[model samples]
Target: MLDLHTHVVPAGIPFAASLAADDPRWARLERGTTTGDVLVAGKVFRTVPRVAWDLHHRRESVEAEGGTGQLLSAMPELLASWAPARQGLDFARAFNDWLADELPGHDGFFTGLGVVPLADPEAAAAELGQIAAAGLSGVELPANPPTAPLHAPEWSGFLDEAERLGLLVFLHAVGSPAAQWFPQPMAANGVLFPNSIGEGVAGLIATGALARRPRLRILASHGGGSLPAQLARLDFLRDITPPLQELMPEPATVSARRVWFDPLLFDTGLLSHLVTTVGADRIVLGTDYPFMPVDPVAVLDDPALPAGLADAVRHTNPGALIATLRSHVQQRS
Candidate 1:
């Protein structure tokens, strides 16, 4: 089965602090007596996992997990859009170079979804052209990039560039520093943070970004993070709120269908509900492999699912999402 929402690290890419030794936003990887943690400005940001860079073992693990193939993206933590433009560009180039190196040897099992310098959208668009030519399907992006929201007017150029380049945008989210603003002892510093994915999707819908780029393929991670549930409410708000009406002016539900969601909700009922809301054709199989504690294969194998729904999620839908890249990949093999 095809797995879309998996992550990987380049073999020799350094910690952000090493790349931008002078940038305060960059984090250094600190090795401790028992564990490793990333320190940003000399404070512990988060602990990391070995599988983040353990390529061969990750390959074997995915194989054992029964995936025929996976789309590899740099973990969102490494997306480092807050870095200065030059440093960000350097990191993006290194990430793309590593993927280019890795893809030639592993024909069917690996597909590269490279990173971009989102801090500079013009540069990002230019690099996306190179990534497309390199046979990668698309790029992975943080839903809440440092520069702006996904649908902000400043992002229109980049969105148009991506659409023009025919690259699918995989929108994933990591914890945001803004999580601190929620309240003391908030779960947001951990679990609730990534719900930014939902915020990004809803923001895009509310602002009519999907309508502007009807053909722009976006695969939202973390089961599109509460977005499906918020669809009706967003639609209602659009009608009653004059400001939202001016922005969206159309039903939010119509725009929601433009996105593809991965079934990483970690619940059978949630997955079934998402499938029903978005339709099976718009759902893809995603494991968040070797990271999140969910079983994509088990979900697909659930006997309670509608007939052919599992197979469609596991294979058919993904194939359609990456149709051009799949054809390119088949030609290479």
Candidate 2:
């Protein structure tokens, strides 16, 4: 399986110290804590130290689990989105440089998606160009900024550049301040479900980002963040709402299909629904590895899926996507 949503950390990232920083977002909001030998979010994550990006270790882990290769990128926490644009850009460059330097010539077992600073578009565009030249496969950005949606005019230039360069844009969910919605309190001290994957998708669609970057190959993490369930509502609004009709004249499913989704939804029911709604061609395999050890085989082995669908999700689709950026690198060389 291609495993499109696994995360890796740059060697330069301070794994332990970054937890104790004064940033309230990482402190109060996410509440990082050490447990036995792993780190668990006060709310949603439980991860081991080994998961932090050792290619040898990852290869062994995947081989043990019966998978073939991993498509790796920096985790949302590693991106440090709460930091200022300049700092975020620096972190991105350092992370991407480390990936380029380390992952090649390792039996082609590892591939990478570069990180870009969405907080500043011009700088991000330049960084995107640099990453493309460096032979990275794609660029990663947050699903939405804490303060604003990605479609805000300030970020359109970066989207434009990514499309022009034929770079795949990957959007991962990051920490948010609003988290008081879950019925049961899973964590002793932090918020839960303030705004979820669904809300992020709504924000992206409402902002007209898909319309703006028509040809950009964009993938949304965590199964497009609650989008499969909300398609009916979006279609209703598009059919009746005059303003929305003007903005998105096509059926809502068309826009939904234009954006691909990774299979990071842990629940089988939800994953199946996402595949049915988006079609098998648009669904890609994503384990969100190291954060959670989702069984790739179990996800693909389900009886609900049609024949050949698993092969597309596991290999063909993502290989094609990565090949797009790889071709750019070949031309540059």
Candidate 3:
């Protein structure tokens, strides 16, 4: 299986002790702790598992699960979302260089997705070359970048760079101010998190991003979040609502299908519906592994699913993306 939605934390943080409290470069892991209490600026951000960074353990787990390989993204918490532009770029370059060294080609089970500091789109655009030089396939950009707006006017240059490099832009959601409004963590993760992806989709369409940069390839996580469910409304309302009619240049579904989506929705009915909504070519198999105990391959294999879907998500769709990734690397060489 091409498990695209996996994450990794550094097995060890370099020089966590001396950095100033204001610097968010490398996260500080509490010394001598095996449980991975990842501290950002001396505060506990999140505790991750050994599967996050242990190659032997992770490869063994993927192999046991019948996975061919998985794409490794720096856990979103490590992305330095709100850090200063130069510092965030520095962190991303260093962090991603470390990830490039861990790819499956080096007897590990990871195909890496590099991180970029999207808070500064100009710096983020320039960082693509360094990311490519590190031999990474793509970038893990935040669905809701803290300082930078997602509108096309502000972000088209970054999109242009990604398209020029033939890079896959994985629009994964991270914690945002809206999540804090929820009363419980579960409500934030289960309700608010997925909906953030829909906002990303809306940004792409309403902001004239895809209209301006048609070749840009993106893969949004969580079954394109709420987009598959709401696209028909976007498609319908564009013709009637004056503001939406002006903002949306094409059918929202058309723009949505230009990107790929992961089938990590918890429901089979929703999965099947998504396949029909976006078509099989745009769907890829992605399990938030170690985070979700359920078997991703088995989810595709469920008798409830349409036949041949398992093979499509497992190989065909992801194979196309991987092919472009490797080709870009080869051209760089």
Best by TM-score: 3
Per-residue CA lDDT of model 3 for 233-312, tens digit only, reads: 77787878888767777788778778888888877888888888778888887887766655644567788898888899
Report the error of model 2 at residue 219, Å.
1.0
Which of the two, 1 or 2, has more TM-score? 1
Model 3 worst lDDT window (10 residues): 13-22
Q: Candidate 1's C-alpha lDDT? A: 0.75
Alpha carbon lDDT of each predicted model: 0.75, 0.69, 0.77
Regions of candidate 3 where Cα sits further than 4 Å from its true position: 14-20, 23-26, 30-35, 41-45, 104-109, 241-247, 296-298
lDDT of candidate 2? 0.69
Candidate 3: residue 331 lDDT (0-100): 96
Better of 1 and 3 by lDDT: 3
lDDT of 1 by residue, 97-153 (tens): 788777777755778787888787778777877787777778898888888888888
Assess the local accuracy of residue 59 in candidate 3 as a C-alpha lDDT between 0 and 100.
85
